[model samples]
Target: MGHLRQIFLFLVSIFIISTSYSQIEISGQVFDDQDEKLIGATVMVSKDSVSSILAYGISDANGKFKIAVNNESDVLFLKVSYIGFGTFKKTIQNKAQTLEVKLSPSSESLKEVIVKSEILRQRGDTLSFSIAAFKGKNDRVIADVLKKIPGIHIRPNGQILYKNEPIQKYYIEGLDLLEGRYNLANNNLSVEAVSKVEILENHQLVRVLDSLEFSDRASINIRLKKDITLSATATAGIGAAPLLWQTKVTPMIFTKKQQAIVTYQSNNTGTDVSGEISNFTIKYAGVNFDIDKKDWLSIQKVLVPPFSPERWLDNNVHLGSVNILQRI
Candidate 1:
């Protein structure tokens, strides 16, 4: 029994020596054509028979990779692939235990990836929409063009909604042309002058607190064409008998460092032009300050029944407003 046990131990030691000799450790470094280390690159070793993968590893941040192969007799092939880079394949001989691979940039792969129907594209925190893709023949003004955008809607009251939420700020060339009353520019601005519309989501209004503060609101910016630095819109109409007339003139100028918009609107057709005026009064802030006596007097008197103010106030209503914005 002692002699048999000695023989069994000798055979087991030989088997372990042979197994260790057959196994080989492979190490390599991957780099780009510019000699920059490529992280997360796939390094694979497969049998020359094209059967199964023998070993695999991913390049680390230092572009170093290590793999192990258990079969030393089988001829192997190494493959390395990464995004925006060309694939590399080479035969691994029995004596070659270390490798260094440099992958070239794949321009052919980039050409094959063509984006033909991309109307909206996102970059960082801003989303840009191509104007030509959304504009139509009947889109005479910017308001008309905005209605055709997928995630944007223009209400009947000229309010702008983005993804079902109202936009907080409207900008022209990175300048807030209208403080809170942006309907003036949206309704009157010409669509032909605009080249693109950018939506800044989760925008931070205050520049100093941008990193510390966060907001859910979004802001819109209009990018005009290169040659369209100056644009204007004018409308004039007249009717006989009752002498009904309306006139609107808007002129705008946009530049890299300065922006200005001047508008004059006058109508007597019962249009509510009070929206153009800046009213800082908040209904829910619990601060009661009445600047207009007529407003308080109307609220104090209880009416007989709820009625449509539009029907009751059928009289001629003359409204004239002038708004000018200049940023330097």
Candidate 2:
């Protein structure tokens, strides 16, 4: 029994040695038709186009590749391919050899491509306006450019309107950073940093009620330039009469992961920057009244002027606001 087992093992070893010697190693150099070495070219050996790959190699920086195929097929197919070049294929015998393959550029010609830009386009319920088309050379802030866009309007008090109606929501890159107080962003954001403005008509503020409830109100979204992630605006002035001074500093950041805006404005010139912080979305949400004792209850208090507060009030005012929103 031991002699029989030794004979079987010896036969297995001979079969493995013969299989190792039968493998055919092929080395090749790939080059373009101009005789330039083509690096990262693919060299594959197979029995036929539909057959499984017998061996594969990728040309190195020197355009040299080595592939060993252990197939016993009498005829083998060698294929070499590279980007923008015609594939080279040839049938060869299963033998050890060297190859010098040259590939030619594809003969096909691509059609001419024409890129046309639109000032405004409407898709479904959304309207997109290109800022470059509407923005004037004199436009400093985004609000000035927004005013130039047809069908959109800006009120004297910094309220944005669409077709004589107010927008339900305001978003900077799809984020509600300032929530209802979007005037701070609309009046302060630079025009150069904005790329496009999109309006969502019949916008449903609540996602859950999108299909259930239909709204006629619209929403405005601002898309910033790709390179503009951080922006700031600072203005300071001193006048001669009454030692008048006004200064404002606003810094903002808008990115995919987060959005933040901080502003500090003080003026004795009656610029009324505090109006930017007032929530203008009161119409959408239920309103609550705040009764002041001096104004509401006291009857003998100094009679309030009918004109705007900025015109009657002659005092220094300072306003500070910070808004931030982060994605979890």
Candidate 3:
């Protein structure tokens, strides 16, 4: 009786081991009717035609997929599906095999997709704001619309502040063409030419040391519309108090290999248009001699009135500047 019991136990153990290793593997490549490999297709195995999923796999970039399902019965159901493609189903035998599935285009039409633009988006350390969502009808220049964006402030001196702190740098299409004198671009650039504004937080200027160094400074970048490579802004005004006049013309060109900005502004209305060309110093930064000292001294001598500059001060000023950046 003892010998018979040992044999029974041995046979039971063998049966259990064989059942444990009874998983059937199915490997296949999913393709369209045109023989094009369809990536991201869903391949699933089920015990019945409409039962719960037993195993599943997604086609890789090469449109290859592999699924392993337990051999519960002699047959299993396999299903493959992709967007805009008809579903493929088959009664596959519970055995390891490879297959190539070709899915035909679906006869049913999909609903119309209405695409909407995004107002704001954040990816990694960069934040992008769309101009169309923030720009108002009265906004003419890029600076006017920038004020409507949250967490951004434009000072009277044309300095851009992000979150109450001054930005470290300003860029146009990833190029620091204006250097620190970005007020010219900010005030003169047309709102229609710009598509979006991006802020790069924790910006590191040096690309070589990006991994080794970390920075807390933030930078602003202006992106132009695809069709707008050349833009110009001109303003002319004449008032009849004491023959006050102001005129400005700025033409700018941005291309894949070159960028240029030329400006000519003249005014007798005490607007101080020359300030646009002066360097905007950031925190913990200074200039050699403060090139804007003469302009500041003139304002001090006049004892600037509490009212607007166009009302009181009588003066004549002309400013012409040309800035160009060529990529090698």
Per candidate, the number of residue pairs that clash is 0, 0, 0
Candidate 1: Cα lDDT at 154: 71
Cα lDDT, model 3, residue 189: 89
lDDT of 3 by residue, 1-328 (tens): 9999999999999999888669778999999999999987777787878564566677888999998777568888987877677779899888889999999987755531101113455567887777885777798889998876756888777777886777778899999889778888988888999999998988888888778989777889999997338888898999886697889999999987788999999999778786688686533343222232234334335455798876776789989999999989
Quote the positional error of residue 245 for candidate 3 in Å: 2.9
Q: Report lDDT (Cα) of residue 143, candidate 1.
A: 83
Question: For model 2, what is the alpha-carbon lDDT of residue 125?
Answer: 80
Candidates sorted by TM-score, descending order?
Answer: 3, 2, 1
Candidates' lDDT values, in order? Answer: 0.70, 0.79, 0.79
Best by TM-score: 3
Sort the candidates on lDDT, descending order. 3, 2, 1
Candidate 3 TM-score, C-alpha based? 0.59
* TM-score per model over all chains: 0.54, 0.58, 0.59
Runs of candidate 3 with Cα error greater than 4 angstroms are: 1-117, 238-243, 282-302
- Each prediction's RMSD over C-alphas, in Å, is 20.0, 27.0, 19.7
